[model samples]
Target: MNIDKPHAGNKFFLSEISFLGYVVTRGGLRPDLQKVDAVRDAPTPTSLTHVRAFLGFASYYRRFIKGFAAIARPLTNLLRKDQPLTCDGECERTFSTLKEALASAPILVRPDHGKPFILITEWQSEAISAILAQQGKDGREHVVEYASRTIPDERKNDSAPQGECYAVVWGIQHFHPYLYGQKFLLVTDHEPLLALKKLTNYTGMIGRWAVRLQEYDFDIVDRKAEKHGNADGLTRLHRPGKVPKGEEITSWKEPKQSEGLEYGQVAILPRT
Candidate 1:
């Protein structure tokens, strides 16, 4: 029972302590500044480590990049066990694209709970979705942020008019609790704004949805498809296969017959 003699159970613990002491005496716990600087200033990865670091940063801002996980699938495959990752032409292109996207990542401004939020949504036949949020302040409306995504094929064919409509509903639902009794505007390119007035029963899923929508006052306005060109392009970028360039060029024509709604005007309809 001598204190100098280590018990069998404590032998492993003593060994760990001895090793740690040796390490500490050999060098302080802090890393070598020169080595640390070398690592920091080291050439950016044109290889596996670079890809992983870029992916890590991309993940940090996943909200800004819709369908980010899906988009990075190919790059992630390079990180799997025993897999040889080569920075071939294709990988190099992707690496450059991701780095560019990361460098110029858009700064999203948080929504103001007090100001009215306007959501512009776009729906595509392919089940892609995009949304742009603008808030009214000081007698003017300015874009607060943007978000977009491509829904799984299975989920696309649902009764929802467009992926953007679903996206809009989801965004509003997310902010509903904070915005209860607050007024907001739902902007869409869909033509069925009048049909939404037919909603009466507030019980089933659709009804519940209507109820939640009703809680916070909202008016559906037609945002001409052409006007949302930028957002539409972003939604297409999330689409599953290669998307051709110049497909986003759209010409917005003035409505032939006007609802006569002026910009920034809100049209409120009586709840059905």
Candidate 2:
């Protein structure tokens, strides 16, 4: 795009670099300490405008914080159109926690397709969350990425089974780019959801969701709820406010008749 000169941000022959607020290195993406310091030393938000400004900035690094939606819920509530601007004890606490979370955020490593992946998904009435991890050379699992979001308002009252099914579906969709053809372990805390693997001709909300799974390869595993406490405590993470570049959030039921896929071929769902 430049006829004579390149952008000032361009650099070559560097061992590491900071790009779009994150530090890029062979190990993976880490938060820039300078940016983290700003968040850590930020003063209390005394006005509605201040609150919004802070969230807008923090959301840029939302990928670093696991349960961002839950932690920011109280603060976001204040953003309601006609709500009064008040920072209660909970809001004050949440704001502090956010600052601390950024300061202590872990370095999220880059995804290596060569290694096997383990995806853990759990859902509650208020939210649905998932964590994608890989076994590092250290023989310990390290998180690759985190994704979570509050369920749509109208579906908040869905039964436990329905919510759990929704979680699995959304989790897969959110990480589709990395998971499309790869065989990975799909972990779920809801025992009822494990049954989807054997379901045949099932026709309902859950059935339609199962049909989407035809696009990927995975084996479902069960985990206990108590084991998922960290994710549950905030009720959990992702790029948070914005979709990652190159991701296409598509409707569930529509299959692209054109554009043949490279990995697994899509199969038409039979009528129930």
lDDT of each: 0.48, 0.74
lDDT of 2: 0.74
Q: Pick by lDDT: which candidate is best?
A: 2
TM-score of each: 0.49, 0.77
Sequence-dependent TM-score of model 1: 0.49
> Tens digit of lDDT per residue, candidate 1, span 107-215?
4445667666776655554434344455544564454544544466566576654344465566665455544677767777777643454588766555555655565
Separate clash counts for every candidate? 0, 0
Clash count in backbone of candidate 2: 0
